[model samples]
Target chain A: MNKSSAPRQSLGELLPKLVVAPTFVVAVIFIYGFMLMNAWLSFSSSRMLPKYDWAGFIQYEKLFANDRWWVAAENLFIFGVLFIVICLLLGLFMAIFLDQKIRAEGAIRTIYLYPMALSFIVTGTAWKWILNPELGIQRLVREMGFESFTFDWLVNTDMAIYTVVIAGVWQSSGFVMALCLAGLRGVDDNIIKAAKVDGASMPLIYRKIIIPGLRPVFFSAFIILTHIAIKSFDLIIALTGGGPGFATDVPATFMYTFSFTRGQIGLGSAASMMMLMAVIAIIVPYLYSELREKNNEH
Target chain B: MNIKRVLIYSILGFAALIYLLPLVVMVITSLKDLDEIRSGTLLSMPQALNFDSWDKAWGAACTGVSCEGLKGYFWNSVLIVVPAVIISTVIGALNGYVLTKWKFRGSTLFFGMLLIGTMIPFQVVLLPMARMLGFLGLAGTTSGLIMVHIIYGLAFTTLFFRNYYISIPSELVNAARIDGAGFWMIFHRIILPLSIPIIVVSVIWQFTQIWNDFLFGVVYSSGDSQPITVALNNLVNTSTGVKEYNVDMAAAIIAALPTLFVYIVAGKYFVKGLTAGAVKG
Candidate 1:
């Protein structure tokens, strides 16, 4: 009986491992494996279809020289900086404002956050119409006797990317607000009371005490916003279609157009590698700190 | 103090209006005739309420070669979202159960690897994924889309379940093990029963994500197999004839309605999931 049961005990231990094995293997192959494959494709001389023949730095050379790629990268820079800054400031303000024991907070919070529930596709399309010169705000303002009031950023080459930023902030600031609100709620009330007892005004207390304590929230929000900004594809597609003529193109759309539509897989892969590098640059330090924190706690 | 009260309420009210403005325009435009949409400003109330665009957007709108509106793509979204959500959540729960309760060697390392999966951009995988899907003969199919979502979603679902299960007392598992409960037995009889809340959270979260996903849908699925988002984009951007703003608005609303419904109905769970996911990260 003891001998028969020995295999059963071992099998019990093995059962859990076996259950976890498929996910582990799939994650390894699909996620990590594809990442390496993308890196390889970026180096190969593949166009129209993937090829395995290695040609060092050729694709990256073309990627850097390509004007459209540069536009995409530039738009990403402008969009990323503005989107992150505006969302953070607005979100922090909203969170701080709502934290003032206001009434109807739930209803107001829901309204603000509803956009985050909608797809960027929906947000983009809605904004596309709202910013269209003839159909939307500009027309309304003109009818209201402001004939020179022109807000046609959706169609302008230089201003199209800013429109993307506006829609993005509209969609995401509420989410940032929610994050900051959670962080603010986590703060000890005693600290604020102590500051008050020391004769610090509300604004000063917030500036010195409350805001400083929300550093982790700001970091996490930055990480999330940066990820969204880099991966922005659908919004650009729906809102500007990366036009008047590819003016608002970001790397994701640039990659899609080249690799899939124009059949420049090598250059597309190179561009994607840059995106992956950007993500890794942001995420690795975050993961390192997160995991180290866990280790120290243990 | 009174002025402060007025200022706070006014600012909150303005923010709320800004957020609601687009949605209101979308709904009103969807209900207006094409002529009204063309003639009136976006802020104007419709002269006559009409559901013609909604009907057309639902049943007759052309997207590429298909003129079947968004109904087919909506169903396609449902098919992809349901399976992907269930499979990922179940796998996540199982993995979480083992990682937390069973505690095998290298489990944390495995988890850390999974966390890395969450951060990488989906673009990095598109080339290989397209090739692999073709190799597996699942390319441009709903099943391929489902597989993609599940693979990407695993990290998140796993994180949710693993974090939740960590708080469960492990002595129960020990007691079950001592009482001759085997691995599957303990999981089925003990762990899963206590997982209803996390399961709800995971399902709602995954459903919204997969439903709202446009990148994977556009990349992986083709033709009639397209999800609502891609279909909506194609419908709105086709530009073959005169552009119909009303139809476009209607289709956008249709595409957005499912996740919007989920948000309205189960908003508490939605916020909880978002905060939990963000805080844990």
Candidate 2:
């Protein structure tokens, strides 16, 4: 604290503050200020352009009343739950298997994670074809003599959101695997050895002890996966275009449609405010708990 | 024991194939002509290696109103990404230095607010930022888009650097200050040389993110100024005389190549970058 201040002011003392000021201002205006601006617009009568008059919560009322918004919200819940769950299962399975000192681990890990490097647009493009019933697996399987093959979820209204989940899981599961693998490495080897010496089967030990201890890793994976699911605009846009009559529209896409294309600026703003609330609802508590734990430690 | 080992290997092999399938399908699809793509299954090889679609996708394919290929947009992405990554990274380094080394009153609070920026859904900022860009006369231009990237990107880049810089013992900075070395001088002389690993981490993270960005590109830029991700989406979605799946696949590959190259070349740092980013606490 003494070094951070000086008896007499020096250029060195003020320079650090000066260097950080621009970013501070940008963060204020862009992040926090923009959030406030969006909230204000949600309450205003803005439609084509932002207007400055309050209109109560009519936009939110409209959002709640609209069937499209409900479908989008429902789709987000389905996608988020499915994506997070499957990624955890598959990623944990792979990390556990790979932790067995597998052969060519680097090559296999690279293969698993390469999808994460590609843009969602690219993943969506590839999966759009791969999931196409006419040209993809359905046709191939029919050719292979399963004449009753009908894997057309890409076009099916009830199943279109699942395709997004497929691509989402494809792109992100490896990250969970990486995090889990790191967690696995950090597990106290002596504890595992003692468990083994006690004649505990490996599966039982993992189920009862090891996997339970990896809760924090799984929680981190959930937060990231939820973020990805909420921000899932490009995947849905590029893959299905939220079609089969808005069947696969998630909140982000719904907000974009209502706000930008449909000129329902107030509706979009309200939808965005909902999204902001959802993020804060999830993240704030986790961050607060983490902050409190750190304070207790000190 | 033998059965268990076999089960593990077979499952691992199957998972690897699942992971490898889409990429393989993408490459194989790009090399085939339209007829071959229609006639062949995803597993079938091209009758002959053909790069015509790649040629068309690179130079002649139409994306809605434009007849030019993804070349202009690829360069547009390059133009936006290089400067945005460098500027954000440098500013982040300075901010990280100040927040950690030159801690002042309320710096922790400032960092807390800054950390919140990282979690913000860009949707919350879209309308306001769009209006801001219009006011600044940068609307529908690459420069405006670059500024947006830098601003949104600050939280991430700063987080990475700040987390990295905290490990540097403060005694070094204090000694330098006592010797009349100013803030910038100590940073250049003492701090920056230690920042290479983290700089690699930051650059790779930012480059991957900004390059793959579709939301900002779509919302901020218009027409020719749009980045490759947006352009690729448009190129695929535009319905015309034929769907031209080959060309679409080729264009997707091109949009993906730069980041894929970075990943293959510096995968260690790429993973490290993600791990560093996950530590938002």
- Per lDDT, the best of the predicted structures is 1
**lDDT per residue (tens digit) for residues A1-298 in model 1:** 4545677768777888989999999999999999999999999999998998899999999999999999999999999999999999999999999998989899999998999889999999999989998889999999889999999888899899999999999999999999999889999999899989999999999999899999999988999899999999999999999999999999999999999999999999999999999998988898788779889998
TM-score of chain A of each: 0.96, 0.96
- Location of the lowest summed lDDT over 10 successive residues in candidate 1 chain B: B272-281
Q: Give the count of colliding residue pairs in each prediction.
A: 0, 0
* Segments of candidate 1 deviating more than 4 angstroms: A1-6, A295-298
- True contacts preserved, each candidate? 0.79, 0.79
Q: Candidate 2, residues B1-281: lDDT per residue as tens digits? A: 58988999899899999999998888899999999988989888998999999999999899878979899999999999999999999999999999899999889999999988888789999999999999999999999999999999999999999999999999999999889888779999999999999999999999999999999999899998999999999899888898898899999999999999999999989988887788565
lDDT of each: 0.92, 0.91
A1-298: candidate 2 lDDT, tens digit per residue: 6756565467566777888999999988899889999999999999999886899989888989999999999999999999999999999999999999888999898888888899999999999988889999898899899999999999999999999999999999999999899889889989989999999999998998899999988878888888888888999999999988999999999999988898889999999999988888889888987888789999
Worst 10 residues of 1 chain A by lDDT: A1-10
- DockQ values per model: 0.84, 0.84
